[model samples]
Target chain A: MKKYLSIIVVSLFVLSSGIAFAYDGSLIDDTSYTGTITKIDRGARVIELTTKFEKTPKTWKLNMQDECQIQVMTTKDPSERGAFKKFAELKEGTLVNVYGWPKDGKWLARKISILNPDDYMVKRLEADAKAGVFFGHEP
Target chain B: MNKKGFLALILAVLFLAGTAEARKTEITPADQRDWQVIAPQDSDTPLRDYAMLYEAGGHDGNIGVIGIPSMKPYRYIKMGVDMHNFPFSGSNAGNNNGTPDGKYLWVSDKGADAVIELNLQTGFAERILANPKPFGIHHSAAMSPNGKYIFLTGELSGKMAKMRVADGATTVIDVPPAPSAPDYPDASKDGKYVFSGNYYHSAVMVFSQDPFKFIKEIPVGKNPHGTNFLPTNRWAVVCDKLSATQSVIDVRQLKVHRVIPVGAGPLHNQPDNFGKYNYISSFVSDSTCKVDLGRMQMVDEFPIHYRVGHNSIAPDNHYYVSQNKFSTGLFNPTGIVFAINFEEQDIDELSPTYGKTVKIVPINGEPHEGRQIFSTTIQRWNTGTGGDLFAKGYELGDVKVNFDEKVPGKGLTKRPSLEPIHLAAAKRYFIPRDDGKPGVTQEGDVTVVRVKAFSYGYIPRFIHVKKGAKVRIILTNIDKAAGLTKNPDVTMGFLPAGYYGQKTRLDGVRGMSAVGEFVADMAGEFEFYCQQFCGPLHLEMRGTFFVDPPGGTASLSVGDYDEISKLEYQVSDPSEREFITGGNRLLNTLKEGNEPAL
Candidate 1:
């Protein structure tokens, strides 16, 4: 399998500002997104999942950017989640679920669920991302 | 090498197309304000095209209404500045103070040793000879409540320049130079007493034109930088930068009331939300501490950013500090405004926990003044919390810092103490943009990629996504000035905001670009933030992303001016936002080969 990546540049401009609150119609309603995680970046506290929505399973990302905001979930022990500070720890095959929308451009996750990372299927994808090959983890 | 090189080249193209940036723009009478999150073209300014204050969810799963939170949250218009065009000079801008009418911006240029009057309405820039002979005009240009006299500090020249505003005349009052005089040559409200900080002389010089003579000098700490008079002319406050202490001097008596050890490097400040408690900024630790004027003791402190030499308190308690010299947070306007809450924690006087401590919280509000990337830190601090901090309902922080500074002085004067605000703020805010919708999209192909650049402190911002073919994003915060992050191994650049609680770690001192690349595995919106205690709005530092449909959305043309202008990049009302921000030569050049040229 082949893997590819894209890079985007960023910049800024100066303007005489006058109440610059642009509109907010693009964001998907928080309740609209539903999916299950296929991976988690523990150190980054970000989880990727193929969610099973009421209509369809959507793929997305979830995170508690600040660790203090990361509530200790009963499903994942705080120690095991220790990797929340190091993204490499989340591994490719972690089974997780998420609910979020397209904020900015990518998925801006709002809710997430951590399925048992021990799930055998998850380990498979983990092996794939590491092997730098195609990891069929999509739901 | 041949096979891998080919694939690598292609991947590089996709990766190159996915970088995110912050651009703060406005709309024309053409209406509409949908924020468009576009990747910054390779240009000089950064953070102006992306969104800011991107919290992943702190409000019980509700991040600070970051750019229209109700929808898919892709395009959010933010507030920031063009760092490349910043009114830069080696000297700090004394750009503080607006006219009593609040219509004009007073650009205090410390380096030029002059005041530049910026007519917001006309966009005209003019210089005013505010003072004379100060090599480093630190700041402290006090406008009379009546706008009659403008009292300013001559930082290096070691003098105070007092100007009579009523007649457009500047009279350089050769006040007796303190050991380190005129850190900020500001005056007391009553107009009867003029106070200036003697940073080098370590003293407070006091005088008023009524007598035209140096009345008294109060001895203070190592290098008192800022001086402000409590609304009541009876007292004056001084902030010592080097030693991180504040001194209170009896205005009439011309005597030192009490010198208290506040935060690390107390530089600029404001009053509490209610204007009763004075909140001062601690530069080195990047913390803002508060003082209960009544009790006269250092109560608490909150973390902000480093080398925050300038600050302002809104008419409300929310305070702001300019991210000076530091590139990452350099040109951010809303990024500078820090909401603060200060309260007296009861403690037994002698015990470690006995003395009362102050608390500071940053806030998010509409940048009331035109988004000039710079808000004054001299807002009047009130002691009362006014209301719940940060969230909209509460009273907004009352501190407003104005820059257009230049004043004339009489023949003689003395100096005063230096210290800035009270404490407890929401976090940090960098740039702002409208939360617009995703651009034209193809139906099927989708891949996710993350770009993790620059990692510092805790709270490393990561972008995660389903790993197929879309351009997913995962960003790393290398800005050490982000005050919200914590790490014992990193030495952060916030002392005035008091980041000392998190000892200086080896990783704390890093340039703006930290890790540089971490791809998202999924195709979705990604979130990022500063993982260390950078400065005032550290927590507010955030950027969002979008993973293109796997095949990548092909555009009609890259350099079509009309298409680029009308394509609705990241703003809903492209015309309106463009009218205010379109003159950007940099924006045009960066997008020259990519987006249509405006």
Candidate 2:
């Protein structure tokens, strides 16, 4: 009984302290941008996207390298890393979060995580309806 | 009294106190302003036809705002010559560059040895950024792609300066080969490098903007004048005036990739939006050549009237305006010298008049260059976030800079610091029924005069003072373009009260009051006017300074056409005047040939 109680206390303490030891799926970066791809220049290996979280919307052209990591998220979390992908699989209108820094006058991409559609507001509203959270308002 | 009645009286007292406190913090009907966001306009809108043209030459430096398509004159904004220490020498205003968002325009006043930043929304000359030591003659400037830095070129000083846009923190480097003159500069689209054309060394000097260091100088043809990078950020094409060819520097390799023959004296060049065609203005040949960028060769040429100096494509890529020099036979001849003309050529394939001179607008003074801006790019009002720290409402009527302390013996005398409340009350003096007082006050030996500047006029239409009195005129601008009207009858209308404040320090902070101090020496009836184009009544915003004579007697002098009529006049013969007018008409009728003329 004493051992069980001690284990329960430790578990509560760890959870209360907010140290979960789980990956949030965000990459380390000098600068980061999460936006939908508007254009893809194959010859230059550059993709243009309007920045998501900025007071003033700005178009950023990021250069993709061969060694850069490209992943597609599977979970509802927008930043969750899931499966590996190639540059050819990337398409316009796909939402992505990029981690990069300026290199040789170009924004060189270090990592690009293609966000899951369910993480966005529209898909989340539908998920909430399936869960019957909205009651009579659910469509 | 009963216990219940006494308790009710106490409750009533507490309720009254709470009501009094609530009224103190209540939002006034005027203060209850909710802002609405305006959607960005399309770049192809016809409202983007406004062009800003500048002349830094003989006839007094001024910026002319002209209309396109119709080719009509609107108004000219006088670049503050009477306000600053550098009185805008009518001969040395150089190149200008606007920010990516078009909120502010940076113009180089070489005569003042400073780079002036103008707030586009209010048309106010906001800040004067002085070139650092060892560098003089601030010639040209280019804004970075991200709008964070301004790359400045010094022609006579043989130096290049990089100024951070947020604060005017500057770093200077020599344009290598010791005596090279950096005439014109252009920042790369990727914001990595600044390419400057060196006239003396005949090379285009490249500098890394991040570390602010000289990278390399690629040898080009003789007299490299204007350097412009294509949209691809791969090639920087430089017009070599003396060699009559363009040196295309491959930015990826940092080498001169091709030297294509363009024409006689190619002075300036600009590439189209698609990076498909490049236009090079040939000064000696009186034509502009269009080069195919992919082929790296001159494909077509369009003849402009005479001496094509600078050329620029419109924002929508609908047409190109060729700034031609030496008016000659284009306009009505005034004297031995004539005025310049801005000739517009249609480039839009959808338009009926493609590759033709659609209109010609004659203008006074010698204009060096012109830039076209879409109205949507400029902010409706400056919020102090768009790199203009000295914008109105950012600093409320307080001048923290001491000009006399920085550069002593200059006209502005020393000013004592005042409290924030004193600065706030300075504007209230102009408004009656607010317990306000007159502006002019005597402080010790100096007479302090406060001038309240707003949209249409300045307070105190006339200032009367004794001769030799030390006068300090502190001009405070209280109007802001941030609020809406309270009338329910009118919708979507904003208050017309935006103006850029002057008096920015060298470090570019804490300039709220546009202050100037001078001894009233030998002053009769000197006139002071609002230089910025505030509104329709901007010309009416003028005031006179009346200084009394030595005997302390105020007097006035009036003059009329009678004085002019007494002077001898030289009249041209009627036949000579008729011939000149007929010649101008014939040239206008004959210059409209269908040949591709830009």
Candidate 3:
């Protein structure tokens, strides 16, 4: 019975250790490159990598047309359920530094520094239009 | 069938046919109620259907709501770009503005040094936040819970940010380093805890409150970049690019708990909404590892979605993974995003072993009253890139009723005095068209046909009205924000596909107003459509309208479309042969939009 219990415990430990320890080792500076932004409307919400390369330094308009993705990793209030909702309420000009690859015209953000965005506004945001066409309702 | 069986079928069909026929000709629900004065149906064309010339600056202004069937359906995606202040006022947009809660997209104009609000639903600007601190505001913004605030990060300015609606002012959370990092700061709840992994400083900093007073700075792996918190809010997974290590921190304890070595390092680490899991992505092998929270280990690894620039999930638990951007032909575009579902691994819905596949059927011509169904490029699939319609089918001027191999037919022979019987139809398909423009393409099988009411989305909510009440409506396909359309013309409104999705003032002091057709003359229920393809539920868009007679109930078969059209022509200028030609053309268009060979 003692031996069986030991075997069962050992198997549980093995099964639970599904996570592999990842110690990222990059001596090289991944400061910059170029790629397209896969998802753009993060506002100040950053993602991990840029998705495309337009191959230029000119300022690209970040809209739904442009692909941009930003990853955000931060501690929570331990209570709030919707983080995106919190991100949406941020004031303009909350600043941050960004390190990324630039391909074509857009940038695939590699690294970002959250800052005071007082002077900064959401880059490319617009309201959508819809027509309320239904039964028995008037324009 | 058999004689009695056939007769029974015919009787049932006829009864159902009577119900169906009555649906089109019956007076609107609002016109049938007691103490309600239902307006008479005018013989003249609807105000929205007629072209008008105005005096804009007294220079003969012309803005006409062109005539297209008001009763068909369409789909589209509309992004907002404020063209209201553009050099050409009328040329830049489709007219009208929207609220911040309405715009579902984000874009940064590096040139104007401004971050404007764009409408992905109609390709128009609802609002604009101008004169950014740095002349180079790129695409960056994050929303807090309940859409109260937004966070904007920029490279030119060195301040960690919060975007509040009041005064559009900025309250500095932290002083970020120069050249501003390429990424944006993601907020926890209520912008309480904002974070930025300063690559220059080689550390990740956590903030507290709105102004962002630093609580503690953790010395993470080299280039402590790409950080995210598990949905559980228990751990903060920081991806350090230099050491190829994911430094895990116990956010609650605010301490460096452990460091995990990810082979080839991680380009990104993502947390699920539940925050119980995190995905570490590797750009090199194009693979990802699923991290287990309990054991602090990598459990499973899978190939990336594509050249995998980034990935996300919809609220419905569907994954939207984007691939590399396009470069002519040699390269696939970043605009190519895929709808993937890996965790829902059961491939048995209808057939135990067969999984569901994406269907892209085209529109085949159908004949209605007089409308002619023609195969046009407008029926192609439309999305953001303008032209990526890989499917085809027969769609119409209104409802996107696309047929598969079989065309649906009906017993159109009219009759009276039959009891009302409803027909149950098998689910079919429709490919909606949004005026076939460059930016809008209404996709899928859901189609909205114009009824004399104001409504959209699924048909769960209804607006009851009285019969014979005059109502005007402007129908537009709205599928962009809902991710259902891919039409350029419909999205951009180059032709006749633009619309304003709103209900007329229910209690206004104009001709007549009420919350809905609540004062219905007759008592009955009616189906409504969102008309625009907002998403999978777009097809289910419908509503009910009740009209009660003077202390009576709504009966079957009132003066509906079939009856009204017949009555309308009687008052028309039948004396002129040319009038008949014009009427014939209109009738042909209607017939073509509906009838199909059985």
Candidate 4:
């Protein structure tokens, strides 16, 4: 009976260790994503955002981790940059910039920053207009 | 009869027979013979009534003449000048623009940095107006309607000059720096304004002809390669190379009025003598688009089998002749000439045989700028004082005669020898591909096959042969005629790494055939396709050439073939994918947005 119990314990420990190793591997090769937040699920610690890439709009879902750093830009001054903030402060309809690594079909966020939504949205619209003209389409 | 009487009669018969034979073999001096004179005829007579055609040899630096309708072999007239000798002279001889007086032909000598005037009758260069600047590449010449002033564009210097014909005085006018190379120059019918097309800039630089002053720069499409003005419509049509559109500018307003889309790589624009239709030839599309000036719309688009450089319309307005420049990939030089019959109201009414084309190799190289030498222009030279100058031992060669009787085959035909390909080692070749891997063949024998290329596709798309075999590919262009009369402009290219010594074998034009012989020194699957931009579906015109091992059954299956049998010829639009990417900044900007502060 003791042998079987030891076997079960070792198996659970090995499986958990594998899961940890995979999570650690996912932390490597970090990239960045910038977009407007479309949805936020606090319970799941997940945020869905729409980003424009190559004049093509794409949606990405990111998971917030415990060590993820957050910052917010509240001033319009070009030199002021941004100040540190909390992940809980992020909300839907807010413009966000994220840095993370992708693994197991999920984006693991390591850093998040909040931007001036109105300014970024206007810039995005202007870009879309220019793209439309280049593609022979009326915006 | 008595022995003496019989001998006398026999001697008389023999003498008569020998006299007849001598007359038959007598050779006539080319200059002494009076063939069809280029003298002016009745204006009411159609241009097709003329018996000859004149073409400018682009690299060859000679003017070639051939029989019209008969489509005979070319007879070359060497442009000999003392200032410019044969070995070191005649670099980049561009378009032949006729002088208003018809006594001389003006051509830009790019290498000599001079504009040369060739006397029409003597075939001798009468004057060489050297460019003051040493590095200027003289490209095109335009004569003032009054016939007193000659205008020329220095393509490399981005400058235009007006020269007085009487005294050879030159006044140079500086214009905006042409980022795109400046090519052809055209003058208004009134001779008030001259326009130069910037090949890379997609703009036309306008100037006052008399004073040689820059007036304005008018923007058109991407890569405006050719420009021509229509006095009847008071419009100038600019052929945009990359944009696949023709920008029509109001000559009076000096502004673009409308842009009509055309085939890809439109290189030259030639308006018919009547000013009813404007024809544009596309380099990449292998087709010619005819724009009806009356309706201001594209009426017809027809294939020319290869990239056409410069075109000339017959004065009688029965047909127009266009010369081929390069193969589809712009890698190989093509010396094919197309004679398109425009008099037929419908394509169906045109003859596929006699009315199509003749293949003639240029004297020095491929023919480029072509201009129709009207009978009126020739007559003026012959009857006027110009004839006296020509009579002084200036005429060079004779016009080619007996075209129908001397040459065989109709439409597109093969040359007697494949000398062009044998001279230049191919840069691309064909290898085999099998099961997503390089095909391996064990065979050591040579394999020979014939391939027929058509619009957007090739016959026997999948070819199976052994490795290390001497392979001979006989290529025939069997593409259907565009509409009822025009031959499909198409060329076949074979591609494989390290095959044919890294050379590409591309030959055959519409209605013509070429043979490619190579030792199948390597084994593998290679891809073959139409090398020239045949039409919109050109990308889909491809096939597989499988080289299998002697004992291997590694043949391409139906599932393995990328079948494009259903594709047809189409005009390709400019791709805007790069613009959509926002000039290589979108990806960087997106990444920068996620960068840590500062």
Candidate 5:
């Protein structure tokens, strides 16, 4: 009975340690996922995201870090970022790419890049359609 | 007593009548006549005796004669006889240079490829000699000092011809082929030799005045474009466009004696009346350099706002008039003439501050080569050589242009209806988005986009819309300067096809805006670009206009639409996943390596 209890306690300790190490803010091994921001909570410094990769479109909670980097990416112009901002700046319907570690069934955000904050994607899509590339034909 | 007195009165009346008849028959010999007294007065003079006339034509194909006073300080009067049958139609006036004889003015007509002699009184042109081949582009004409022959330089043919004034017989001499872009031809004071500058050859070709014989090719500097002979100084100054040097050749020896450095792209050099200083005009630097003949060095330089072309000093030596050729761009062919005051008695004379005293005269047309119309020979026809009269003002009427009033495309029925678009220009960029949002995506709505044209490129270089959509584009120029310190004038041109023609153009002045409207009716990809030579990378400033078919539903996504997979799709290719993962690793490594060592 003592040996069995000791084994179970050891196993639990190892699993918790693995979970904590995954969210230790090691950006080198961080996972990247692109999604749309569905909701934001300035009080809790958290955001609700929906990704195209998942069926049923579950709203996943993502926690922000004190050093989290938020950037705006441009197609040809240089990417602009590095200014300090609050969680309120990230609005709903904003397309973003999140880079962080998964912890406790949620993502701990290391960086979030706004891919089309100016809605350039809409223009680009229109251009593609005019070029017939969206319809899989040559213009 | 009454009979005797009547007889005496009759004899007295007969004697008076005989004396009057004798005075009427008295004639002066041609050799002893005071020809200067018969010379025409300066056009600017309130009271003038004779009128000096030459053929004047505009770029819009209007040809006529302009008359001015033959005396100093010449001014323009009304247009003289009009030439209804003048040949050749182009942007230039076709008449490049003109020389006035006592009764007729000989003009080198580049467009007609012929030498036309115009009757000064009637203003009608008659072909004195015609080129066997077309497009000779005759540049300048120099009359022999003895007035026996007129030497003309054929710019395109690289040949020089001596046409006999009396018989209209021409003797052509072909210079060596490589450097044969000959420009100005000037004769020696003794009328023994003629010298022409071979523009591409960087040399001066000498020919005998009488027979048009190629005497020798005297090498000078790179791209010798202009040659002028200063009779008082006995020196021939040749301006080299490429080397920025003046080859001062000794006329007696027919060789270059010294090379004096001048401003960049020194094109034409003219001497003051006393030959004290030679004024050199540079095309690339937009400045004029004054070279002291006695010192054989550049003594002073003055900035002329536009590119300096041919220049001439006033006969009184008080000031000089220079022609300015603006840069080649859309709707910028017309240039201005500037009179720079160089009065030596002024307190700020010949100093840099003296440029403030300059006067600008606006002119309609492209005026390049010009000269003051006063000549001792021309004055000799009026009175004796010692008469107190000097010819002053130039006849730039030989090169004039009237702006074409017709819009680029007036009768095209297939023209598209253009809406209004606005653009903003920055240094090296043209931002097309006005509201800080992406371009319009809707198909049926009016497409109004604004764009800014500046130094390097246009922002949002790509645009798309449905076919038959009306497009309006407004452009602004915000570039501080074009090159080092020159202000920029931007021109935006569009081409539905691949060639340049009657397309839409939006021209904007510095800190100003211009508007253009067109229809994106063509269902294809077209390019719009800067029309002017704005900067080094001006050709690369272009944007795409994409027109799609109606009713096609295109997905609007941040990334590539085709690459985006469905929600249920899983990563099937392991190599694809590896490539993406590896690319990110490489990017992180590079980003870390590029960081400064703190």
Candidate 6:
């Protein structure tokens, strides 16, 4: 009975690990934002985005780490997991929620999730309000 | 008037008149005439040497030939036009470097999947090689050192094509695998191997030219864009755009020799005439740096305008031109968009004006790539050097689409109709769905819409999708079948106002289709339109992309024309004083001949 229990536990751990790294892998304890990609330097693998979190539209240059996890949402549900994609597939004008941390005085992207068009309106407005685009909505 | 002696004058007046007539007839010598005074070249204004700048046309689909020093337009080579055997546009230039002999130039027209050969001596297209499908979207046309073959990169196909120049026979080679976008391809100086920069990965892929097989991948910085082989034949430099560095590869050993740090976005690499110094153009950093090949270290850096896309060193090593990608706020705002400029800097160390910007030449379109050739190589119209294009039996007007063995049936005048296929795919959108929303249907998980693009407009002008639904747009260009626009290369993009990005843009050739899928995250109306300039009504080639709120549908009814008329009148409000006097008050005062108040 003891051996069987240990085997079951090991199986559970392996399955979870597989799921975690299935669509690339994300860094632990990183801040995330949903923004529109404004510019891209394909050679540098860096992107300039206007995040919805600021009071004004602030351009943020985020460099993708070599091991950064990238996924694209394939379903209408924002929470649904999507397929893995290469860094070259990411194009300008894409709406994405990026998880990143500050490293070496630069924004290092850990994971990038291309957002679904269905959720764009709410997120865009939320970003607009945070950017203080509306009167009396200053933050 | 010399009625000199008014009375004695009857005879004297006649003599005076005759003398005046003679004086008027007497002319100055032709050589002594004082024409428009142009400053002559002196010690301070030494006459510069001559060179020809061949710039790849970004949107205009023409190669601009400009004369150096004079800063004058020489002529333009039209690509993928009626002038060429293969008629198309939206030319995405690969490399502007002429053949080894400098007799021909190879450029890629991505829209047509054809690489055009331009005769440098004749200024006319010599041939068009339609690289077969699955080897499409050719980006670079790097000619071999022997000038016998041209290597090309298919960005979307993830493949590299090697075409024999003599017979135009093309052989497709797989790059690596999916996720590998081979961007710039170049042949080794010794012509033994070919190298391609993998845009997706941080490595350069090498292939043996003789056997045309993959050799190995050399690890480098991320997003290696351009690979330039030095004249030394022992070393090659790869611009790692994303890594902000350049990697030097030892061609003899086929390994990375050094990775030198550079400014952000090192895009293109150009070696000076002697191959001692390499010029790296940092696009995002808006600067260009010179690296000493011996030490593999940057020696000097010069600041340039915003976003230099491509740079070229003069053949004589006297000047450097940085082709800035953007001109926003750099020049006078004339309400016109796409105004670009390139800066020319003196690089000669012995010159007193070295390191100074010699000229800032404004161009109409973007300079995708540029090559500087010594003036002695090609004869110019100013020199009346060689056989003119007209003398070679080239027509000024559009030639009839001709079929050739090199590219069979590629220049077809009529394209097959895709209407039946489009209509069938669009049927699902018109039928009421389970949710009672017409023109929107959820298939399993995502909502799909089929759209057809023609000249000046898109079918189903309004595309409505529910908020929170994933939307996939499949766009097809029917311009060739519709025969509406003369130029049929149309790209439709789902772009909202002030939004930047070409990710959603679907580029298509006539009778070709493209697909773009994304989540419908935003609610409210966006716009979809032809991104490429097609004709006079290009701006009108737009439609509404409506994202309705969840469980709510947008009102698509125009109701009546009277309602729009009333709305327009209500907004006009002619009673406002500003409406009647809309001209600038200062301009009005000036027109009345009054000094305007400060």
What TM-score, over all chains together, does every model reach?
A: 0.35, 0.48, 0.33, 0.43, 0.40, 0.49
Judging by lDDT against the true structure, name the best candidate. Answer: 6
Model 6, position A17: C-alpha lDDT score: 83
What TM-score would you give candidate 6 relative to the actual structure? 0.49
Candidate number with the higher lDDT (5 or 6): 6
**Candidates, ranked, TM-score:** 6, 2, 4, 5, 1, 3
Best by TM-score: 6
Q: Write the per-residue lDDT of candidate 4 for residues B387-470, one digit (tens) a residue.
A: 343233221111111101111111112111101111144322333311121222333453547666666576677877766667
Q: Which stretches of model 1 miss by more than 4 angstroms?
A: A1-139, B1-99, B130-140, B177-180, B273-275, B305-307, B318-598
Which lDDT tens digits does candidate 5 get at residues B414-448? 11111101021111223343333334534346686
By lDDT: ranked, best first: 6, 2, 4, 5, 1, 3
Q: On residues A1-139, what C-alpha lDDT tens digit does candidate 2 reach at each position?
A: 9999999999999896664343221122223455679999977879997754322345788887543545553334312323456677778998776644465667766456576555432243234335432211001
Candidate 4 lDDT: 0.49
Clashing pairs in 2: none
Model 4 spans > 4 angstroms off = A1-139, B1-51, B80-101, B177-180, B327-364, B376-598
Comparing 1 and 3 on DockQ, the stronger one: 3
Candidate 5 local lDDT, residue B137: 43
Per-residue alpha-carbon lDDT of candidate 3 for residues B107-162, written as tens digits (9 for 90 to 100): 33222223334322233333334332222222234444223334454433334544
**DockQ of the two-chain complex in candidate 5:** 0.00
Model 4: CAPRI class: incorrect
Chain B TM-scores, listed for every candidate in order, come to: 0.41, 0.54, 0.38, 0.51, 0.48, 0.59
Locate the minimum summed-lDDT window of 10 residues in model 4 chain B.
Answer: B85-94
Per-candidate iRMSD = 24.9, 22.2, 21.9, 33.7, 36.8, 25.5
lDDT minimum window of 10 residues, candidate 1 chain B: B496-505
DockQ of each: 0.01, 0.02, 0.01, 0.00, 0.00, 0.01
Error of 4 at B570 (Å): 47
